[model samples]
Target: MSYYDVDAILTDAQKVPCTFELTVPGLGHLEGNPGAEVKEGTKLELPLWLAQMLAITPAGTKPGMITLDLPDSLSQKVTNALRADPRTVELRSLAPHFFNLGTRMLDLFEEEELSDLLTESFKLRAKELADHAHNPRGALGEGAEFLQGLDENERRLFRATHEGAKAVRAWLVGMQKK
Candidate 1:
């Protein structure tokens, strides 16, 4: 079933679950048009990892914190839905403020179609960062240089990711005020 077709809760109010159709292929579907409303029953593909993420089983999924990497242009209706529902608080830990810098950078690009040049560059740089992180066994600020090349407007949006992280942390902290 698609994300839009997803049943938040089964008849007994249990969390509805579905298995992924494909492993590495992953789920991806359009969210209506960019500037218009999507009719009901619109198909929204759900990736395999997401199915595991929402799965009721463990040892099948990565325990503790996990991040679902998504494209910048993507809009997950289920994320919003789950976020709104009190029963789905388990997801909040992995959802908000997980540092989706990929989407943030793409948003900074403002591209209707991502060019091959930019895509290739990002891949190479990402590999470099990955290698650096792996070798150092510590951390990598490798993205800082490429990120620095972006204009102020882009940096503003990029920084917003960290800001969102801070806000989520603060919100959780304040919730303890109860």
Candidate 2:
């Protein structure tokens, strides 16, 4: 992801659960207790940027300072829902930058199942999105609910698809007139 990407920045700002592995002095401000020590095993929701840094940064011979956990958006419940029916899952409700966040998380954690699930989900959703885009009544009619559930990337795809269809139709009409 590019550093200048607003979506990437927003994804990095999203909070994720983290557990402190070791007690650290004057770090309680993260939990709203300023000037206090952050005790071991203290769990708190931290921005992905900070959490990722802390989780990967080593201290002496030990591995990292904190343990990172999947955000609620990518939890097992959501996974189950996607696996059951990807088209039915409202990805925007889960996370506006769902796919982007998933990509970032995949970099830190090795989850083959999640990777496959996301890929399959995107494939299914994109096909459905394309179908809806090509339909003149899709936006305001039956496919409205599905369109509303699209995440950032999918929305862009839908827009592009819809515009392409419109352009093609306009071209055909001009040809017929000629």
Candidate 3:
């Protein structure tokens, strides 16, 4: 997650559910009530950057100003779907930076199940992605649906794998000519 990485920036801009733990003055614009104070216990979907800061920053003796919850993308429903069939889940529909957001969330919350599930899902999906990438006709054929569901990182991996295979073939052809 480099400072200049566009994907990282976009991932940080993704919204996550948050509940205000303490009422503060003049912060209602976040909830679309400009010039009004955000009341305690108000729930809002805030960008990951803002929500993370507010959720971790301490106030006096209290822990923080807001409590952060998992975004809808990482909800129990999505988890169950991934557990059932990682290859079938449309990760891009959930979030463009699904894995990246999951990594960031894991940094904040400790969930062994989520951690293991994400790792296993990625491994499974990557194997499938590699297979599709290596097959020239796969993208346009039955694999199209799965390819379309790839998130940012997976898409990059697919492209790299596809291109690498192409390059290898080209090299082999040149060798044959020689």
Candidate 4:
């Protein structure tokens, strides 16, 4: 699904119970929560925002200390893919989601290597897209059909390149007219 579709759901997602027990009480109250006593050993169901914030720092920093759960490692298969050529990796099919997830929840996961690899891949792939847009063959060519199947995120990237190409192409035509 697109980010827009999931944004609302994730924004208002109910706080789920976590296994971590609080050593100290955090100031921010969860939604639907009252000023209940929050002492040590208190079990808390944290909202996504609060959980993300708490997870980012060391456990001892928060006066309302609590256990912070770390995310599991990415699958070995995914790790292998990150090591592969970014150009061959399909952005529309997989990379976009990985990049987005890793970016937003960077503190929660130890995927810095993977994120770096993906970022490089995006740069390479974007250059390829721009190059293709700058020099189109024809409507029936492979490039046109390849673009037809892009997901929204990929399409957005392609659209920017395409627009740049269109502007340049128009300028060339105007020069010829002049």
Candidates in order have lDDT scores of: 0.36, 0.93, 0.95, 0.54
Give the clashing residue pairs of candidate 4, or none.
24-64, 24-65, 25-64
What are the per-residue Cα lDDT tens digits for candidate 2 across 34-101?
99999999999999999999999645667788999999999999999999999999999988989999
> How would you encode candidate 4's per-residue C-alpha lDDT over 1-178 as one tens digit per residue?
4657764345324243344445344443543345544555555666545666554565566532344342222345554664775555444443223444445544455677767765775676667666667667742376665455343455677778879779988999999999
Candidate 3, overall lDDT?
0.95
Q: Which structure among the candidates has the greatest lDDT?
A: 3
How are the candidates ranked when ordered by lDDT, highest leading?
3, 2, 4, 1
Off by over 4 Å in 4: 1-74, 138-153
Predict model 4's lDDT versus the native: 0.54
Angstrom error of the Cα, residue 68, model 3: value is: 0.3
Native-to-model Cα distance after best TM-score fit, residue 61 in candidate 1, in Å: 61
Q: How close is candidate 4 to the true structure, as a TM-score?
A: 0.54
In candidate 3, which residue ranges exceed 4 Å CA deviation? 58-61
Once fitted onto the true fold, the runs of candidate 2 whose alpha carbons sit more than 4 angstroms away are: 58-61
Q: What is the TM-score of candidate 2?
A: 0.95
Residue-level lDDT of model 3, residues 1-178, one tens digit each, is 5789999999999999999988989987888899899999999999999999888854566678899999999999999999999999999999999999999999999988999999999999999999999996987899999999999999999999999999999999999999
Q: Please report how far candidate 4 places residue 91 from its true position, in Å.
A: 3.4
Per-residue error for 105 in candidate 4, Å, reads: 3.2
